[model samples]
Target: MSEYDDDFAEQGQAVYEALLARTGEAAPQPRLEPTRRVLDLLGDPQRAFPIIHLTGTNGKTSTSRLIESILRAYGLRTGLFTSPHLVSFNERIVLDGEPISNEALARNWDDIRPYVEMVDAELAEAGNEPLTFFEVLTVLAYASFADAPIDVGVIEVGMGGEWDSTNVADAQIAVFTPIDLDHVARLGSTIAEIARTKAGIIKPAATVVTAAQHPDALAEIRKAAERDEAVVIAQDVDFELTADHVAVGGQVISVRGRAGEYTDLYLPLYGDHQGQNAAVAIAVVETFLGDGSQPLGNDPLVEGLSEVTSPGRLQLVGIEPTVLVDAAHNPHGARSLAAALDKYFDFAETVFVLGVLGDKDAEGILSVLAPIAARIHITASSSSRSIPVDELAERAAAITVPGLVHAFDSAEDAVFAAREWANEGTSRLVVVTGSVVLAGEILDLAEAEEWKKA
Candidate 1:
């Protein structure tokens, strides 16, 4: 690598370490004042551009990326900010479809560090905790996007919608993707409670686009929109996924968008849920660009969906023995992964390398996956919050046959053993899943160890 690249890497790492020194994402502060304070000092960069804000239990990142891709296809410079990046910190921030350059990330961090410190002092004096990792990161993203002067910002909520750090921005378009029970601890236990928390993103007179939701969740969202007098365009109602067929790399889908019907769109992503997300994204774009009345040009729609990619969501990383990685951390996401595996692949036997965070429902995830897994190698990711391997194995054994469960101290060892087991069979597949952190680790290992070359 060139000296410039090396210097950029170093500076980026420094910024990451500085952010790590603050409170982490797992224990996010459920207040927006700190973020709003920093933004106020930064001239409210979030207000500089109109935002398309998204919040839900699942598919938020993919839906956010889909919206950004379609907007970029329409020749608009877009800014995308999503949470808990699979690989790099830079992955969380995208400018015009590319991960922010390391130089730009460092420069933006430097520019905002002083204001962040000022907020920290104010909070300290007020007997409150300073800004968190997510809070500061949100400030940096808004500042960077304002500096870029993006045409629109596609911002995903860091946690629940109402008080989430990203919610400080008044979005012109509010999007929802399949509300379910995931973060029961922080958000809420029931679907209704969770949906109410998520519905906090809806702004006054905004255009709301939602995927098909459970009755309780849908009711909460409708109530919020009604209060705000926002127009609600819902899936299976105003818009729908008319048809989806399994294809070579992904699937071909037809969506009846709010403005028009889009047919024969080649989306290079797996799962029926993704087709639903595409429908929602199309509606969001339709609402954003034309108040849900004008049809998007066919070229932009086709090209946008064709190029859309959601990495670590049923992503294929290896050949010959065929290895895949998915970031399905919760049961809701795991159910989608299992369904996609059944519909998309023809494997006779499947070996799983499963690791989960402590807060996640390991039993729920295993219940969904164990029915399809030939053997599950239990392990933990490098995250401090990861469940211990032995504890997870015990839980898995209760859900499935004891003979079908194996434990390992590390993800790498578990994956090595799972790959070896899969290699012995003709139509066997290997999958790494259960946590986004584990997915990111295996993805990095896949690149470093050249898993594809095998």
Candidate 2:
């Protein structure tokens, strides 16, 4: 196992251990008290840096990464906080373009530990429970960002935006990547309801930028923005991705937009969805800089878009059998993945290793990929919300297709089984997706094996 200096490791370990002990305290009720308490105890460190709060069912993570990179390119110290780290917990906290170092973790944990303890004691006395996993991590992220002296921080909501812990920060700018019908049981059952939940992140007079496609979702967001007196900029109305030209081994992309036409805009991500995301990022920069009475120039905009890279979105891990991983946990994301897969890959047949959370529409995701996949291997993710393996298999079987279908107890086993089928000396493709949690666990196992090789 990798080892660090005992002192630093001890501090980091303490933070996680405390969090572990507090898990399963109670099902999270929609309350903002825990987040507000943490912020108050820390002197509201979130306000120390200007923030761009992003929330949506899908595209939020990619959009946040794009904005952070663009801001950093404009020569600002940028902090990016996202969730469900693909490989390590450190991936959730990035300063500039790098993950938080062990030194940073040690320092931030030491600073926040006292406040966390105080909150724990207060909760106990009040007959309340300790902070949840996401709440504590939210506090840590804000503390780390403030300590880094970041000029700007892009925060992605971990779940529904309204009462989510990250909502404590009143964003100078609020960006909605696109709202859809996922997390229905928690957020609400309709797109409008989901959009309303996300729109709660907006604060008074904050500038709102969105790529929300559904008219109902946009209307709800516009309503919230109007109520809060926030400025709302919708993608189709305010900006657009006119065209995109990507070259071989080239990170630069050529795009034309409503603001102005720019060439060689470099973004180190794949898919046409990225082209749309780039437009939103540009609008955010314009919103922030334009508020200063001096509009942002094309030079900074170009530089910013050119430097953004989000890992695990069609992330290519190896050649020969061609392993790719994406966190397409919902129908919106699944459709995007299917589009990208169709555009970039052409195999004789395709094999899919799929698993999903219980709360997800497993059938919907399976339907999206049904046309392209030659075989489907269903399995359960390593999360508490994972759908039962047998249940997922039954759902997949119900989907009509000529493709072969099977099920397994775990993602690791399903992946291995799919790998064997794909490596049968034919031109077959393998895709592992369905849930972010599943993707993370699969990636973790792959990296563990890779480390063993080294």
For each of the candidates, the C-alpha root-mean-square deviation to the true structure, in angstroms, is 1.2, 2.9
Return the top candidate by TM-score. Answer: 1
On residues 352-386, what C-alpha lDDT tens digit does candidate 1 reach at each position? 99999999999999999998989999999999999
lDDT of candidate 1 vs native? 0.93
lDDT of 2 at 158: 85
| Top-lDDT candidate index | 1
- Residue 360 of model 2: what lDDT? 81
**Model 2 over residues 360-432: C-alpha lDDT tens digits?**
8888898888877888888877777788899888878888464468888878889877778877868887788
| TM-score attained by model 2 | 0.92
